[model samples]
Target: MDSVYTDVGQARKAVEQHLARACAWVDMGGVLLVVSELVTNAQRHARGQWQLRVQAERHRVRVEVSDSVPLPPRWRPGKLDGSGGWGLRIAEQCADTLEVLTSARGKTMRAQWLHPGRTGVAVA
Candidate 1:
């Protein structure tokens, strides 16, 4: 599935609806949430439209979001007061592999989570 979100709010709903159909109900929530965060980040920080793709493969499910900026995501420690910058941190913990690829056209953030049989294990 592929979607184009112009803003953060749209991306959230798009992720949830799309992931729910692509992944199992039990794992849909986590995958959707992670995809939402990634898409939201791109929508907020990047210039043009953001693209999202969710696919279910043999042993895992993959979510990829592309933006109009070549810069990769930043993973800085959160502030004490009330600021939050922990999206990438949470995604790293949840996903088996989280990759950020940058090019002149844009940057793509891809997150992969394993299926039940794989138990989130990486294949070598």
Candidate 2:
């Protein structure tokens, strides 16, 4: 979680490794997708450091991205133009729960994912 750039590959790798260690069988692709969007938004808006946290629980994987910006996200709808501005929308659709929280220092975007077998996400 560097302040300079949001490396999506690194985030994905970290999450994948964590899941592997825990022997969790959650939806890795959806978790990676949510991580990518949160990091992307943090890089685009948050003016200061952006930190990524991934936690593997007994039945869920929680991904959180904390940034310096205190303001909340626009939460815009998906675009039909195909120019590629649909990160948050895709996250909403894929993740089981995506939330935003504010703190004294900044804001955090949290996304949780469950296994496809449990939630019928069918996103293989």
Candidate 3:
């Protein structure tokens, strides 16, 4: 459903927990990274609180972070030197489908990744 995360660490734990055994197929490390970026961006760039919503299907998992600010996310070109402004790029690279939706009130950054396997849990 929907949740509000004041802290990035706690939000990550909740996301992993909710995804359950499905994380085995969805690359949990990548998923968590995307979540961290989205949530942190919302907190740092937007006013008021941020909301986290996740939807897990048979083939893919989608994570969305919404905020009150209507400003759109900026995409920075790839670079060898690691620095700021890389969050959007990282999410774009990791996700199967990445989107930024803007409305009159605010915007939502959505990241989706396909599961690695069709089974309940992928074998390691």
Cα lDDT for residue 28, candidate 2: 73
Q: How do the predictions measure up, each by TM-score?
A: 0.76, 0.80, 0.80
Report lDDT per candidate: 0.72, 0.77, 0.79
**lDDT comparison, 2 vs 3, better candidate:** 3
Pick the winner on lDDT between candidates 1 and 2: 2
All candidates: CA RMSD (Å):
3.1, 4.7, 5.2
Top candidate, metric lDDT: 3
Off by over 4 Å in 2: 4-6, 80-84, 115-124
Per-residue lDDT of 1-124 in model 1, one digit per residue for the tens?
Answer: 2334145566657666665666653366677678767866765677546887777766777888887788887788977675768778877777878999899988889988777677757653
lDDT of 3 at 20: 80
Clashing pairs in 1: none
